[model samples]
Target: MTQHRIRNKNLGLAELIAIALGGMVGGGIFTILGISVSMIGSLTPIAIVIGGLIAALAAYSYVKLGLYYRDEGATYSFFKKIYPNSHFSASAIGWFIIFGYISTLALYAYTFSSYAISSTDFANNIWIRKGIAIAVIGVFTLINIWSVNGMGKIEDLMVYTKLVVLTIISVVLMQHGTSSFGTFIDNMALDAEKSNIFSVLIVASLTFVAYEGFQLIINAVNEMTNPEKNIPRAIYSAISLAILIYVVISLGALFAIPTEEIIKNKEYALASGAGNVLGKLGTNLVILGAILATSSAISGTIFGASRQMSVIASDGYFPHWLAIRKNNSPQNAIVGMAVMASVLILIGGLELILEFGSITFLLVSLLMAVANFKIRDKTASSTFLTALSIVCLGIGAILILYYEFTTKWEQMMAIIILYLILAVGAWVYSKKNEMKGKSS
Candidate 1:
């Protein structure tokens, strides 16, 4: 007889939920607040709720597949194992997902930089901001590479603290609100009449990106306990809490701040809005929340994505050196991702990176839903819900593409070119593996 032990499984349900929340709560809400308000007006909260529902749909399949497979490689691992013979499928997903993580890594860091310096005199200095972004990414990378338990504890602290700060900020904003609840509802009704259903759905689709980080929970499967029970609980609970937080925050902003100001100071709308209503104290709280949100996001993104990248590399889908791990941590992969994200920060254009990240993740989530539907029976997923997830994600993907094409064709083209480059890289590596396997 052989004895087996699961060593160092330190993540409980709270930490698991924290990981999912930390991943989902980052720069997403801060970045999207202004954009969603600008597009949907008082209907911003409605769209956010819709977006969360869409996220739940996407999360359904992930929970099922994650529990079924329990692979730390997450999205890439699930696909690779499900379609073992199709190297291109594995390679393409690997490329899309890794780059998707890179884009988000850049997004969260860039958002962190924005809120970090918003109160300083050097706020408008692009160079200074980029430097801060790079520095933060470096700090989180070291934290991740140092110890998994350290990273988890830090993540739990950051996520919970940010939630507390955010709640305080939301309560303060509402207390000082200039507009009444009745007026807000009336305003929403007025805006709803002028807003098209398609446009609202598009905004919701764009918001799919904000819900991006919950899958980080799946990436930590190796360190977690009771995958069958915890995976679904953590993901679903996190998504539900995210929806509540986003809606409340949106309501707070809408009731207290004017639409024009939100549109004008889109980058730091909450901070600016708080400054007007609650003065410097209010502004400072909002800024604190944003910093904590983006910080945890950066740390969570690096922690989960690097592990997946190392797994992909070990399987020959990425550079071999990226596969190197020390003390159960992929140090090299974490540093590599941070370097690339830092470069993106220097490149600027936060909105571009945000949209690209959103689209990439949306597409990847859609694929996961499809994969789950294929194995619905094995995963014990609801057939109808799995099919619905597929349809909803598919719709969201198309809406984003349509919105990009109509509003920003040049940016859309750049995203397309980026995808093509990734596809080519995938083809090359996948072909190399195929040839090597045949030769053997």
Candidate 2:
């Protein structure tokens, strides 16, 4: 006789939102504020809004595919299923998307260390920051390896608490303003007049990395209830909330803090701005918000990305060792990802890491858009939006590359070298898997 099995369905819409929000709202806003402000001044909010729109565009395809396939493996799984005949496609995407997640892991950890030490006596110590970043990655890796349920509950607490604290900080910053609202508006207008449309668009494109985590909801499809309804609701709701929160925070910073200060202290811009304008209490609030924000992000990234890695590994696209699990968790993959992120922190510069992450995700999301368009009928995705998404994402990818090539050619070369390395690695793995299959 055959036996049937039952699975737990405890997660609801709220927790799903928390997962998506926890992934998207981490160190992104904190890290991008200074870079955006430096490029576009007070018009940063406009660029942020555009970035959010791009994220929404990317989310549409993700949501459609998530519902159609309902796979926990997400990007890698989606592509593999769509192109099952191509080992190259599977291995390449597995490498690209996993590395993309690794970049984000580094991004969040670096931002966490920056804020964690921003108020300390050693705020400017580079080595200390990197050390702390690695330490936090270790902490979260253990948390993720320990228990999925524990990670989810902790993610909920951290994400929702950070949101409330961040909103309060924005309100307080607006109320205790140092700059006049009129001046802020005038500055935005002046910046808009001075900056080119292309620059604004490029910055918006780069900022797309900030919205990279919304697809994480799809990764938890097995744990969540009514995934068909909840996936769309959670993802869209999280992106909407993230856009509103980012806009309000950007506006508050522009009104209450000097643009120069924000650009100057880019690493800890929010806390720095709050410290200057709103005093110690304000600074403390910002610090707490940031710490919570990055904490949830690290935990969530490990939780989601490790699962994807394990899936890829099980298919022989990654090392077989990474497929090992304990208590139904991908503990080895989680630890491996954390270790790689730590290495990235030690060797990588902030701007290089940020740009690489943005470009990688933009490219990955663009691929996703293309994949969705190819199967729009089956996924029930609108062909028009999918086509539009491909165009926008493609343009964004080109603009980012153009901006990097024109200005930061060295970093572009490094990125190319990294891609080549990943390609070779993926090619080797794909060949190995093919050979093994033939032997079998």
- Which residues of candidate 2, in runs, are more than 4 Å off? 1-6
- Candidate 1, residues 47-164, lDDT tens digits: the string is 9999999999999999988989888899999999888999988999998899888988888887788889888899999888889999999999989877777888998898999898
Clashing pairs in 1: none
TM-score of each: 0.97, 0.95
Residue 433 shift from truth in candidate 2, angstroms: 1.2
The CA-based lDDT of model 2 is what?
A: 0.86
Tens digit per residue, CA lDDT, model 2, 1-440: 01110254556788778878888888878668888898899888889999999999999999999999988899999999998999998999999889888988898888889889987898899999999999999998888776666777888899999999989888778878787778887887899899989989988987888888898888877777888799999999999999999988888788778888888877477777677777898899998999998998888888888889988999999999999976566789999999899999999676676676778889989999999998999998888999999999999999889988998899899888888899999999999999999999
Error of 1 at 329 (Å): 1.3
- The parts of candidate 1 lying over 4 Å away from their true place are 1-5
Error of 2 at 363 (Å): 0.6
| Backbone clashes counted, model 2 | 0
Global lDDT for candidate 1?
0.87
